[model samples]
Target: NTFFQISDLEKKLEVEKEKTAEVSGDDDQEDKVSMVTLSGQEMSFESRGELEKAIKEMTSVVSKAVAAKEFRKADDTQKDVDALIKLREKLPSVFELEKQLKVMKQDMDKAIKAKKFALAEELHDDVEKLEMRLKTERALQPPPPKDLAGRDTHSVKSVPVVATVASAASVRSAATTPAKQPVLPKQPLEVSGPSSDKTVKHLRPSRPLSATEDESILSITQMLATKRGNAALLVGPTGGLAGILTDTDVTRRVVAKDIDPATTSVNEVMTPNPTCVTMGDSALDALSTMVE
Candidate 1:
C-alpha cells in the first residue's frame, strides 16, 4: 500500500515539476527541496534540528525518493509534514501526546515490576509510536508567516486586503445611512430623599497596580493600606486600567471562593470594566449608573 501511494505521489509530483519547468523555463538544479504533497499543500520546516534529529517518521515514499535521487518527490512529503505540524500547534498544552506517553511509561514500569513482560512490551511499542509522532510533528512545523509589509515579494497579503475592503465598506455604509432623529431629552429624575453634601468625588482616589507587579505578593488589604484607597486598579503596560480590585472583590472572589490572597493576582480576582460617570454627572446620575 505504501509503495503504491509513493508511486502515485511521484506521478503527481512529476506533473507539478513539469508545470513548474514550463513556467520557469529552466533546467532542474540542486536547491533545498521544499516539499508540496500530491494534494497541493505546501511543506513546512521549522528548524534544521527538527529535520535532522529524527528520520524514522519519514514515510517510505520520502525514503525511496531520497534513495532514488528524486529530491523533488521527497520534498513534496514536506507538505504532509506541514499539515501534521499545524495540527500539533492546535493541540491543547495541558493534555497532549506526551502526557499520554508518560502515563503509558508509568504503566509499563509497573508491569515490569510485576513480571508482566507481555503488557510491558505492548506499552513500550505504544510509547515508541507516540514518541515518533511527537518527533515528526516538531520537525514539520513551519515558521510563522511574515506580516504584510515584511512579507517577501512572492508572498500574498490577502488578509490585509480583505481587512481594508471591510473597513471601506463600513465607512461607505455609515456615509450612506440616514442620520438618526434628535432625541427630546427628558428632565433628570428627581429623588424625594434629603440632599447629601457628600458625593462620589469625595471618595478616595483610585490607586493602580503596575502590570509587572508580582502576583504572589499582591494583597488587597496591603494595597488598600499602602495606596490609601478602597479600590485598587490593575494598570496595564500602557498605563490604562485593566481591572478593579476592591474589598467587595476580595469578599466575593477570594474569601468566598477560598482562594489564598498570597497566590492570587489582582487582575484574576478583580472586576473588569468597572462603571464610571463623567464629572458633569450629578450624584443621583452617578448612583444610577452604578446601580444599572
Candidate 2:
C-alpha cells in the first residue's frame, strides 16, 4: 500500500551521494557529513564565500582570455556564468549568493556605462559563465567549504641540509705559462680602374648579386667616351675581358651571318679574366699590366 519502501529509498539516497562526491570532490576536499536534499536527492553544496571564490576564478580567467585576444574562449566562459545566475534566481533564501550576482552585475554595468565596450563584454561574458557554473553546481553537488577562518593546517618548517665531507689535495703545479708573440699585420690590396675623367659616370659590377658571375656593364661605356684609341676588356664568368662582342664584333660576326643576339648568350660575347691583381701588388705593377 506504501508508494515505496523506506529502506530501499535510503540505500538509493546513499548511492546518489557517492556519485555526487565523485563528480564534485577533488582529493583535497573533505567528505560530506550532512545529507542535505536538493533536487529531490542528498548532496552537499559549497559554503557562500567558497562559492564566490569559484565564481571570481571563472571571471578572472575571462579577463585574462580577453586580454590575450582569445574571443571564442570568452564566449564559452560567458555561457557558464549565465547558467549559474539563472539557477541562483531559483533558490529560496538566495542570501549572499544573489548579492554576488548583483556585484557582478554592477561591475558589468560600470564597464558598459564607461563605453569600455570590450571590458564590458568580457565582464558580461564572465557573469553569464558564473551563472552556468551555479546551474551545474545545483544539478550535481559541489564539495563542502572549509572552516570559517579557513585555517591552513600545513606546517612551515626549515628542511635540514646534510653535510658533504671533501678530501684535501696537495698543490704541486708551477707558477705560469709564457705569453705568445704578436702577429704581423696583413697588407691591403690596391684596385685601379682609371685616374682620368673618361669613365667617371659609368657603373661597373665588381661582383654579381647571385652566383651567375655576370658583370653589369653600364659606367664603362660612359667612362670610355672621351678616350680615342682606348678599349678595355669586360671580363666575367665567360671568357677573356678584351674578347668582347661589341657593335664592331656584332657587325663582323652576327649581322654578317644574319644571326641575332637574342639567339646568343653573353658567354658568346664577353671577355673572361684579362688580368687580376693580388693584395701585395703595387700601383706601379697595375700601370705596367694596363700598358701590357
Which candidate number would show the highest lDDT if scored against the true structure?
1
Q: How many backbone overlaps does candidate 1 show?
A: 5
Work out the TM-score per prediction.
Answer: 0.30, 0.19
Count of residue pairs whose backbone atoms collide, per candidate? 5, 25
- Which 10 consecutive positions of candidate 2 have the poorest summed lDDT? 162-171
The residue-by-residue lDDT of candidate 1 on 141-190, one tens digit each, is 33222221243332234335545655675555467753622221211111
Q: Encode model 2's per-residue lDDT on 70-161: one tens digit a residue.
A: 88887666445333322322331122334567799999899888999999888887788567655544444222223211322211111111
Cα lDDT listed for each candidate: 0.52, 0.41
- Against the true structure, candidate 1 has what lDDT? 0.52
> What ranges in model 2 sit over 4 Å off?
1-44, 90-292
